[model samples]
Target: MMVGATIIDIGTRKALEANGASIASGALAQANDASYDIVSDGGGCTDAKFIISGTFTTAPTENTTLAVYAQPLDIDGTNDADAPETTRPTVFVGTVQVNNVTSTQYFELLAENVPWKANYYLHNNGTGQTLSAGWKMDVIPYTSSPSA
Candidate 1:
């Protein structure tokens, strides 16, 4: 039985903010609104692990949560250059809550089973906050048996 995991660098160290724009109160913002081609590395994957990590320069209100969601894209035929359909429904993955504090803070979340070729976003559940640059989200595909 040979098991292995492959780290899919779909997107690394992607900024959570757009053009240094701060997330408004109780707003949902896409992580750069970029579409990742998960099919390249997601083939034969039995499961997927998602990791989102970042620091909040402007800390959110105490006890507030940041929710993560993903929407799968529909590719047209075999042409990768064609624009992907973005009308698909989004699925909730997971969320992380903030502690009671007003200073810069770090946070991380781990989720599983996120769909491939999906675009994800963050929903701010409290007052507006500014995320520091260099925030990242990564997806890791796992195979139960590599030799199968």
Candidate 2:
């Protein structure tokens, strides 16, 4: 036996300032063992839905950049050399990954329960080839957390 389902529609609520929507876009960036910022690198809002999509320049080989939701943290007490790297503290609410490097293959990560601290990052681990990519994020603010 199973229970019934319930659904709600969240239309564009421009008049509702607290529940308004927003879009964040980025230009194409080339990478080779480099990281690029996609969304709020150090800031985010709860009760919001995020749709992150992007395209790559060429078909990456077996190893390519990884799309992740992580936070930056102070590694050491005082030394700048001891600071955490760009893609440090990989704390993800969901399994995030970029499947391939093909131009036709784009990556889309849907994060809903994203905390107000996590930031989106794209890590390109390609050794030899440089891959060009661009990313976009659609943020939908909500009054309360949405159901799964």
Candidate 3:
């Protein structure tokens, strides 16, 4: 028997900033502080795609590169908020490059091959650029067939 691949939308396009505040330039912050829990699908997620879309409030002086990362919880399913500072580690998945970004300009980055983990986080590469108040990131995980 073969099961069709299933796609799971982690958080329904959750905003990078929880409070609807602009992400300041030269700052590194987590996307909603592990907002989307990837383990809810019985931990069968094998691959994922990171979708980031939003407008830039403050454009970068030069070409800007935004990097996305994923931070998984401990093997015992310990949340970052409860784990020790030194136990959590983030893995670099991919990046989006914005050239000549302008205010109110819409941009979208679709990064593939992002491994499914316990959780995820978004990091802005601090290129003197700020995302408008409504930036959003969506994580879509693809589950492999049980018999595959």
- Candidate that would win on TM-score: 3
Q: Which residue pairs clash in candidate 3? A: none
- The CA lDDT at 77 in model 1 is 48
Q: How does candidate 2 score on lDDT? A: 0.36
Off by over 4 Å in 1: 1-20, 55-58, 75-89, 102-104, 127-135, 143-148
Sequence-dependent TM-score of model 2: 0.42
Write one digit per residue (lDDT tens) for candidate 1, span 1-148. Answer: 3345433432333333333234555666566635444456556453555555555665566777767776566645433322222232257767778765555445566555555566666666664565545455555555443333
By descending lDDT, how would the candidates be arranged?
A: 1, 3, 2
TM-score each candidate.
Answer: 0.58, 0.42, 0.60
Q: State each model's CA lDDT, in order.
A: 0.54, 0.36, 0.52
* Candidate 3 vs. true structure, TM-score: 0.60
Misplaced by over 4 Å in model 2 are 1-4, 8-49, 62-65, 72-87, 93-101, 125-133, 141-148
Rank order (by TM-score, best first)? 3, 1, 2
Best by lDDT: 1
